[model samples]
Target: MEFIDFFILAFSAVFLFLWWRTCFTKTKPKNLPPGPPGWPLVGNLFQVFLQRRHFIFLIPDLRKKYGPMFTMQMGQRTLVIITSPQLIHEALIQKGSAFASRPPDSPIRLVFSVGKCAVNSAEYGPLWRTLRRNFVTELMSPLRIKQCSWIREWAMENHMKRLQIENFEQGCVDVMEICRFTVCSILVCICFGAKLPETWIKDIDGVTKEVMLMTSPQLPDFLPILTPLFCKQMKKAKELRKRQLECLVPLIKNRRAYVEKGENPDSSMVSPVGAAYVDSLFGLEVPGRGHLNEEELVTLCSELFVAGIDTSTSVLQWAFLELVLNQEIQEKLYEEILEIVGKNGLITEDTVEKMSYLNAVVKETLRVHSPAHFTLAHAATEETELGGYKIPTNVNVEFYIEWMTEDPSLWKDPDVFRPERFLDGDGVNVDLTGTKGALKMLPFGAGRRTCPGLALGVLHVNLMLARMVQAFKWVPKPNEIPDPTETFAFTVVMKNPLKAVILPR
Candidate 1:
């Protein structure tokens, strides 16, 4: 009995030693980055849980405590935050290949499925490259975009006409709704072949409008099961997804029909209107990437519309509000447009580039009203080291983009909406949004995934701005103060949504 007991004890000891070695051995991840300490399993998510809008106030505090790059745990996941340009450049631009992958987004899959159309959410692979290339070359290319100039002019013309109608006697206009509709019209024309089927058009527009609210920041992305168990938001998202899907599926079918006919879809394009983004993207297969099916095409279209609508519209509305609030800057931009572009019926792409002050105004608005507050999100594809710490595979990373843009260290007068700061304007460390240096201000985000539509967004903002300002002068509503208060349902939206009267300039 004694001999048997000894043998059994020895066996148990060996087994325990081996199990411990296997479980605790971490090779590549031993030296990632450092961050805030938190309780085991639960993480520092509680610190960010209930903000008026997803931790905006907490961001500055976090930056203070942890510096630009810090560590936090959200539920079972551990994450690293990158706050500076150098670090962001390293991860996104320099080591683009290894760190470019996204976290598992099974949730988005219920709405958007596989293939060439799902560029943003698609796994980092050839298919995504194909779609991106298509967008860059066929859609946003210089020649192709010029072809669609007529579409933009048409959309801008219609938008100005609507503003004329809504300007409360052409003195003040509802900047928020008007902006949303303007962006929606431009995106619609570019994406779904302009004159869409009735059901399709309504479907795309309704969903496009709702996208701003749908992507509202949630801490539960890291702990998704919690969303199913605790959040009512999932239910609402489901209902909205159904509404969007119904509208989009038909447009995909229509385009597929056009592609099936040997005729190039580009034939129907109206210059400066629907241009070749639609004209160029059809039935073409990427070399390594497979062709997109119906569902994929629909998802891509949906992404473009949603992404375009809120961000573009919000910036335009804010630009106008700044103009109304600061009549001086408004006049400055107007004078530049008048001097160079001549208050012409159309503000062409090149014409937009010439007005430097107008460019500053748009940049300033983006600076103060930075969208995608927590931008460097999702996961890493591989294990890597950032700032002397190991980032494990699939670990979620968060960057306080809005906070970084507004960081006093980066901007001289961060709170003040001064477009002049972007001019030959001088300050302590260069003004982040200044035209020459953009590394500091990540209004369009940073890295390989930095907004592909940056150039287009710039033109969109400027064109709409020049057209609206030249066509009508905005006035604050009588006895109603314009509220700069922002509540994030996505894109750091104006809490009250800028309300004003329009005066024809």
Candidate 2:
């Protein structure tokens, strides 16, 4: 068929589908939570697409109109958005099982997820349990994390050297990009069992970034029937995934080879610190599956790499900016660090635990500038009810987590950057897991599906922030005030990247 003829045929089919659905199918789901009425067929599709970049920010306005629990129709998919803490607790905590599974991955996303095999993408079943259990116990346990402190220390040393060089030559440093590279370095060691060269790390980080951008919601994601329209885009996504595998597979093979020979991979680059994530996957057994293949290993490692690096980097960047803009806060944090660790003492994990003020600052940063605006899209395993409203199994349940942190009822001055808030009252002794106490803020989500890497993520932010402050006094560049305006780039980040002046302490 000619290209124009094919286009006309596709358009005709879509129009016919919409016309038939309007005439015969039910427009509104029964007993669904209140929401803005959607037009037939396309059904709020344009509204979501128009504000896709800032939709997380738009949830508050929708909550005002439709109450805490609201629903939106995106083509054939039903999205249930919960904004209130009570409803969030009721669904994810009170009835955790019904909502534990992840929503279905769009076809393109499955290419990266390797058919729902990664920890973050797996369904809540034997497979999910096994993956989560292995990851938490073998890879991210407190003991394992402590054993790998050398990796963080190595990355930290590299980070300081790079920043010192940049600050000396440029007068001001671009902290985000520098920190991203540093975090990538740390994760490469953890994921691959070796500290890769800067060039290799950048290539791996680069391909993962491209894959992440490609995996963001696309038109075919909402309506599978329209996938034909996105053939070119889908083709590009596959190519990116191939590039990602090419960058990572060699490291996986090398790690496996070293393990088979009973040797530590890249002994010169990495210490004999337990096993890397890839090392643990060699003989991993699933319920029906005996062991993971190379693609599955790559997928899981990629998940680990992507999950830890970007969010941690973004959080680190935000924490640094906050410190630079609020010198008093920075000094207070430094004083606490100085008292606990003393002058020139390494800010190890043990010392980090003793710095309550530093912990408060980290918590406050997470609350104020959560890297992700929403939890991974969750779904009902079966027909369910939330907040006295029906939740159909076909719907995707999305919690606007940023609103929870910003809710006035839960916080005093939600706009302020005051770590002191967490020093006392309801904020004190707050459980980040959100399984205990009230669900105030959960940047890593809550209940059964809470991020298994939560402990490691917090440690990364705290250690990096403490060391940065302890080593230097961060100040805004002479004529540059940090812009706190927010933007979404796979994660919530400062719209304007932070540039800071650093002085030796």
User: How do all models score by TM-score?
Assistant: 0.83, 0.96
- In the predicted model 2, the residue pairs found to clash are none
Q: Compose the digit string of candidate 1's lDDT tens values, residues 1-505.
A: 6988976876566446534543575232355466667544355766556444365556667778878887776654666777776676667666666676666653533444442245565556776677677777756688767866777877777777777777646566778777777677677767765554334455666776675456544545655544544346667776776776677665555554554553336444333323435444556685564565555556677777767777888888778778889988878777887898676645789888888788888888888877667663646777777776777776766656666566677678789998888786633234333234445677765565666677787788888888877876677889987888877666777888888887766
Model 1 CA deviation exceeding 4 Å by range: 1-32, 50-53, 106-110, 113-117, 169-171, 196-202, 215-220, 226-239, 259-281, 286-289, 343-345, 376-378, 426-438
| Total clashes in model 1, counting residue pairs 3 or more apart in sequence or in different chains | 25
Q: What is the C-alpha lDDT of each candidate?
A: 0.67, 0.85
Q: Which 10-residue window in model 2 sums to the lowest lDDT?
A: 265-274
lDDT accuracy of residue 239 in candidate 2: 87
lDDT of 1 at 389: 72
